[model samples]
Target: MDTRYITSAAKPEQLPDFDLPELAFIGRSNTGKSSLLNALLGRRSLARHGRTPGQTQMINFFSVNDKVVLADLPGYGYNVARRDVAKHWQPMVDTYVRRPNITAFLCLHDCRRNFQELDERLMFMLGRQLPIILVLTKTDKATRNEIRKQKEKLKKRMDELGIDYQVIIETSATKNQGIAELKALVLDPHLQVEDENS
Candidate 1:
């Protein structure tokens, strides 16, 4: 069966004790993070719809197979109108990434725009320990050449940082592009070694 919804955690303390591995999805608000999560699970709308510039309030959870958990973190880059919201979310995201149970992080970015400095900072901060999969989402909205250009820019930045992520994927939930590869990457740990080895 395809992965289905199990439950959500509004707070880190409420998260259950699970020896199984955990993965997280994080990005700026409206970066299509929730859409990608639903796409990864092969469901239309499993993860809730977030605000245009959302508040960082919860660490939502889903059952990815029976062996692992998927944590949907509050989107980090909400606007200034929600300064307090960002304050609340920044700590939760920092803690979740540092948590012992987290296996990896799927850091989603919008393909149509230049990535922000904060994105780079977050990657720099988190890359120290957990593996991060840099996913360029909404590729369908951009031209092929544009996609290529953006990919190269991201690669250069990552290489310069010397923070090797397990892998980088480009996806468009609308076109069903790169969804299966992402799901497999998230579901199977073996791919990470081979991906890094190659």
Candidate 2:
């Protein structure tokens, strides 16, 4: 699939006009959000990766196959100082989430750590509108048993909260695991139909 960088918006009003279906990826800082985006698009550095956490401070958009738009939202829950920055960006995320064109959310979580409070809050906020595909990132860094446990734990939490989710996928950008499934989930019309029906 062909993909190109679009524009970065600090606020919702600054976002470029686009009518195509949009899917957004969001997670905590250093949670492999950029890496997963690069993997999905089959590009090495399409979404720039930074050494510092909370480096992505704006809402970034990328056009894929001229059919769908992929949004790389700023990561949340970094540190006290960065948390303040995240507070400023939260409203922008809220506005974008409410946009009519956004079809779904690819919510990434680090498989190595237990789900944090920020992840729960984010899920609560986004789950109300769009169908979310919970992605467990950096799965290669964890053992199979650990991955399975984390998935079950997260699924239970999501179930308890009554969050709307399509699936929980384990991914390792380095290993190229779950990249195809993630792409299918994002681009497959049949999956969207099934999600809407569900």
The lDDT per prediction is 0.75, 0.81
Using lDDT, give the best candidate's number: 2
Give candidate 1's total backbone clashes: 0
**Candidate 1 residue lDDT tens string, 5-60:** 76655655666667778887888787888888887887877887755557546777
List the candidate 1 regions with Cα displacement exceeding 4 Å: 79-81, 193-198
Q: Candidate 1 has which clashing residue pairs, if any?
A: none
State the TM-score for model 2.
Answer: 0.91
Q: Give TM per candidate.
A: 0.89, 0.91
Off by over 4 Å in 2: 189-198
Q: Candidate 1, overall lDDT?
A: 0.75
Clashes of each: 0, 0
> What local lDDT does model 1 show for residue 29?
83
Tens digits of per-residue lDDT for model 2 on 92-117? 87788888788888899898787777
